[model samples]
Target chain A: MEDTGTRSFVERLLQLDRRWIFLGIALAVVVPFLVPGFKMRSGVVSPRTQSIYDTINGLPAQSVVMFAFDYGPASIPEMQPMAVALCKHAMSRDLRVIGVAIHPQGPLLGGQALREAAEEYGKQDGVDYVNLGYKPGGAAAIKGIGTNIYKVFPTDLSGRNSATLAVMQGVRTYDNIDFIVALSSTPAPFSWIAFAHEAYGAKMGVGVTAVMATDFYPYLQTDQIVGLINGLKGAAEYEDLIRHPSYGMLGMSAQSVAHLWIILTVIIGNIAFFMWRARTRG
Target chain B: MEPGEAVATGMYYLSGPVIGTGVAVLLTLAIYSFLYADNPVYKFAEHLFVGVSAAYGVAITYHMAVLPLIIDPLFRPQNTPSGQPQYWVIIPALLGLMMFSRFFRRYDWMSRWPIAFMMGIGAGLAIPATVQTSLLPHLYSTMQPLAPMAEGRLDLLTGIDNLLLLVGVVCVLIYFYFSLEHKGVFGVASRVGIWFLMIAFGAGFGNTVMARISLLIGRVQFLRFDVPEIFFPPSP
Candidate 1:
């Protein structure tokens, strides 16, 4: 009779200490950042990131744009730069920006972006941009904006009423609001498009984590959403689109090396599997 | 620094003898300890992540939901024409409040409306967007020719890609549709569909691993580059 167990080598391979795998993954990442030599030439810009640029770029000077800071600190590395770049670009164009957050911390993050960008572009706080901070309603807040933008966001980051400002006067609803850019780690962007865009035909933009991109592609294809900045890759793509370089590129180069490591590991694992299989079969 | 700002970031920089190495090594070991067996250290970190995230979520909801709706319209109203209440919204708002009462067990059913609304709306938003964003565009994108497109003419490469995508997608769709039995052409089609699914999964896995590795790189950059001030100051 043929030996049935055959040392159950594949099982042992399967049972191989997972700690080693974790360590390998850790090193696979850690080594790349410590040293330098990796570089990235701008690959072809995906249409997704470009449309966002074009949409923001195309708007007239002092166009009123509302952007959300929806992610937390963990997501800052991937998301904050896109928010900053877009804020900087918009402020540079003299776009009147309204910073809001579905996330509570959004006011802080969004305020910081507007302030930094304002300083860089020499924009006045109330004149160039306004940080609406965090609002009360979830999706309902978005729907409310269809009727009254001021009612939804009555105050700035501070307690001051929005009606007191020049920026808030003509902006009644989503109709007057030139563009809606939502930066979310969660599902906020989709809701904004659904509630506000569907209800009021607000021009919509979304920047989200990459894993969510596959889900958003249908919206992109339908032309319901004008642009997408997905994951860090999408952020990197956006950085390329802006002609300003930052962390996205560093992340990309590290990512490229790590990818190559995994590919090699897979190849080696496959070879070992095939060899073990053939010996047992013989 | 502001009152809310966290300066420590859990990092304690010190001179000589790998002072942080104790914690760094312990944390690394603790995180990795989950693989060998589940223990207190692993549990601690996991709980810490969950607790911090939950606190953030609760705080956000307080501002984003409670303060704005129940607190604002009821007590503190701003930006009103006459400083009066938008009292009509209180009905649905009350219904929304009934949701948190689920923890009381007896009042659990009240939460159904809010939960159902969330689910129903999420599904509602997702379904239409899915068709508009994912299904149609992917169908169009995949139809491109494997080679190149002719200028001012029908893009040949697109057409070829379209053919492959069409065949693959249709077969994959058929695999899910249990209206008919798997037989003859259907069996073959479903098998071919598996191949397309496998290829897609492989690519997804590759990209996903790359993404995860990048996240790990960020953590490492913090450890080696950010923490070690004795060796290096901030890169400027």
Candidate 2:
């Protein structure tokens, strides 16, 4: 009778409503914030993230570093933190930052990051940094920038002449750029690697969403990109390196709890499946 | 100053950010309602999001690409550095306009010209660069010396990693080779390849989960902290 009861319980678990899982996820995410003095240590920085920090840190003051914003609002949570962190790091290092975008929504998102970081650092517009903004073609536009930046971005995002901007002063092409970092939720990094890195030998790195991170390992290993920042954990690692904890660090506790919830569910679901299968076979 | 009056004054000062935050919170909650069950609220939010995104795309394209690249260059020649019309802009603009021909059945074939031009140019530019950046470098990295020497002596760990990588790559490649039958030694290699592929897939899936959880955490943070903060500013 006990054996039959145990079997039925497992079967019931197997048939558990998915809404329960959703509620569990919500609780897991919420409880961390509610708990008093709860904080998860932003763990040891990964070498891949370290490589990005080191690359930026190693650059000389006033070196031109271009950031390609190639993501949309859907990716704001994952992509924006990296952009802000990177922008802050670059500005702190006194590097001349130039922003560009291949995605339509990238300009606005990139501009927001730049504005936030600039405000923190008290950096001036046009003189310290400039937003070249979005262009239509992806790989082709990147190639055009490699040839003549003035021709591709004749005017800045605000309709100011590119030639008149202080940041654009000697930045004619990839030859002038010290480094390029493409923050993307799309395959824009590959386009940069092809046109900017391979074609013109522009040194580059990439910050990508976690799902796309695995796809770029081969490139990272081959030194096609100087470094790779993989999603939010990567953003946290970067925040730690820069000694300024923001959204990335704040989200770690909730992220950990939610992940634990997922793992627990997966284990239970698997156990229930196996038990049900054995019962059916018997 | 009275406390209620101070609160009212603060709200007036922060009206813009507060109203924006309220709308964001509503939309977020409406979207999350789908978790309970697909309802009108969720459907309304979803449709609103889609419509807004489409409109934003069109507006951005015009401001970023059309106005500056085509209209300004051709019409307002004074805006150009040379202070003369860029005739070259007309060619690309005409090609871009040809894209709209697909909307009309009779002239739909004209769309092929721009498509072919783009494909031809893209392939011509990408093939050589892809080979140099992706294919060759990957091959070179894979062809590492198994017994790598660091300083003077052989690095055992490095050698082991290189060997494992080599074996994994070879096995995976063999698994994709379908000309021969899966029997004898080939079958064993293919099975090993399957294990490697599964491990890769597992890692990819884990990363994907992490990405989704991070997004959820972001929204949750906004609701938990940002919303309240917008209404009640912390004293300096």
Candidate 3:
């Protein structure tokens, strides 16, 4: 009777309400922030993040780097920190940053990141930076820009003539730009690889959501892209490298706690599954 | 408090930070409510997300692409050809309009012309790029020297990693080769391929988990740190 009772309990445990897991995750996220003097230390930096940092570091001052924002608001959490860190790093190095987005919502997000970073560095707009705004046509637009920037974006996001912007001077195509850093959550990275890098021989790098990061490993190995930054972890690593750990560090602690909770649930659930299976077999 | 004072208090609460926090917190809670069970709040939030996103996309497309590229060139005065209308935009404008023909029963066939034109251009662009960027490079990288040189000698660790990668690639390719039957050596190779596939999938899953957890952490940070600092400051 005791054996049967224990087996029933194990089975019930396996089938417990998913809300329990949700609540656990909630507490895991909340408790860390509530705690005093708790900070998540940055782990060993990946080769990928190091490579991206090196590429940006190597650029000459005032050299243009096109920051392509190809993500939407839904992906802001993962990509925003990356955007901020990259822009911050670039501005600190005195690199001329040109912001553009293939996705509609990307420009709004990208513009915000640019403004914040430029403000920190006391950089002037139309001189040190420019937001070319959102362009349409996806891969075709990338191709057009790579060929002739004027043909693609006749005006900046603010409806100012592209020809008049001081940043636009001597920068008409990918040929003039030093490097391209594409921040994307979709197949936009592949499109950049296919169109911009291949056609124009533009030196490219990518910052992608963690899930999409692995897919770009091949491109990195082939030297098609100079470097890669993978999701929030990658952003945190960059932030740490630049000595400006902000939201990325905070997010990392919560992420680590939440991950531990999930891993624990998985282990417990697996044990219950195995116990139930053994009982059924007997 | 006086009625006038109450009105001022209400106006202060309606400022950017307060309204932003209130809406964001409410929406976040509504979304999170899905963990318990499907509810009206969750559904409302879901619909709002989709509807707002769609409208935003349309508005951006019109503002960024359609108006500037097509409408303005056709209607507005421009430097092209002595301030004359570009007129070339008419061709593309017609093609784009034809896309709407699919909505009508009889005019459905007209949509096919534009569809074919687009497909042809897409295929033309994609084929060479696929070969150069993805397919050819993939093959080239996969066929790397297993014995990597390190300080004028073959490095054991690098060689081992390379050998394993080579084996994984070859086996996986063999597994997909339908012409061969899974017997003896073929079966063993295919089994090894399955193991490699499982490892790759496991790595992918780990990455996906990291991404989802990162997004969750972002929201948690906002609610915990950002919202309070912005909207509900502690009294000095």
Candidate 3 lDDT over residue span A135-224, tens digit each: 777888899987788778877788777777888789989999998999999889898999999989999999999999889988988899
- Backbone clashes, candidate 1: 17
Which candidate has the highest lDDT of all? 2
Candidate 3: C-alpha lDDT: 0.87
Q: Pairing residues by index, what is the TM-score of model 3?
A: 0.94
Question: What would the TM-score be for candidate 1 when compared with the true structure?
Answer: 0.80
Look at candidate 2 and give me any clashing residue pairs: none
Q: What's the TM-score of each model vs. the native? A: 0.80, 0.95, 0.94
- Give the CA lDDT, 0 to 100, for residue B186 in model 1: 94
lDDT of 2 by residue, A1-282 (tens): 998999989988988999999999999989998998788776788989999999999999999999999999888778888999999999999999999999989999999999999999999989999998998889889999888998888888887889889988999999999999999999999999989998899999999999899989999898889999999999988988999988888788888888889999999999889888988899
Q: What are the iRMS values of all candidates?
A: 3.9, 1.3, 2.4
Q: Give the C-alpha miss distance for residue B71 in model 3, angstroms.
A: 2.3
Worst 10 residues of 3 chain B by lDDT: B76-85
Query: Taking the tens digit of each residue's C-alpha lDDT, what string does model 1 give over B1-236?
Result: 33123223312234333465546545655775786689999998777778977998798777656676567676766534336666876877877888888889888988998888878876775777556545565566655555555776777766776678678878898778788887889988988888888987776665466456645655565566545653343333
